[model samples]
Target: MSISDQIERLATAKANIAAAIESKGVDVPEGASISDMAALVVKIPVFTEEEVFLAAHPVGSYFKTASKGDPGEIYGGRWELDPSLGAFRWRRIE
Candidate 1:
């Protein structure tokens, strides 16, 4: 498919996912949680951890401590993932 076609499909898929999630009564952050926006990223041929972080951290600034990690450091913005970590990292976008 053409690039435009791919983009359109992605956009549609994202919208559908958003609607589905909204239907679930979950408050989705505008630019956080690729999974929250899985409708779009899941359709892509490939995605990266960084992209996930970007998707989850739309504010592009600020940081929060990961619930589980070395018991310190690795703030939310650092983008570290560990089974011990519990809190979801995110950015507040206006």
Candidate 2:
């Protein structure tokens, strides 16, 4: 498929995923992309100790920890400042 077509398809998929997440009563953060919400919803096991540690905390909780001078690691992911949101968002590495 053409690049534009692929992008359009992806956008549609993201919208659908976002709807599903909302239907589940999970709050999708403002300014967060659907893909980000999907990542939060679906937990693919990477079989690591860190993953276990991360599974216990809810999304965005780690940002608070990091802000207190702790390491920037959040539930097995990392926190990066999203300038658009003017806040730190959890980013899971795949």
Candidate 3:
């Protein structure tokens, strides 16, 4: 199934989901819409990939790998620049 389909399935989850997100520093409340969660994944981050990795992974450094083609074809993909977003992110290639 598609990511949208999977998201539709998770739309039925409880408020604890929002609580979990908020606990991590995001201000979203338990009443936030499911689309909010979905958007978080696809949204263009305000920070650069190196910044994000530094913030999340601390000691770890992120490496950039050239796309063999359309990255969506790879099974386990790595971070690549989304020109539209101006940030690099881990996009799952199915």
TM-scores, one per candidate: 0.35, 0.38, 0.27
Clashing pairs in 2: 54-75
* Sort order, lDDT high to low: 2, 1, 3
Winner by lDDT: 2
- Tens-digit per-residue lDDT, 1-94, candidate 2: 9999999998898777777777766666776786588677864333466656666544555333334332344333554444334444444332
- Greater-lDDT candidate between 2 and 3: 2
Candidate rank order under TM-score: 2, 1, 3
Go through the candidates in order and give the C-alpha RMSD of each one to the true structure: 15.4, 15.5, 14.7
- Decoy 1 TM-score against native: 0.35
Q: For residue 2, what is the lDDT in candidate 2?
A: 100
Cα lDDT of model 3 by residue, 28-64, tens digit = 6455676776555443335665455445533223433
Task: Score residue 77 of candidate 2 by CA lDDT.
Answer: 54
9 in model 3: Cα distance from truth in Å? 12
The stretch of ten residues in a row with the least summed lDDT in candidate 2 is 62-71
Q: lDDT tens string, model 1, 3-59?
A: 999999977887777776666555556865456565544443455665565555655
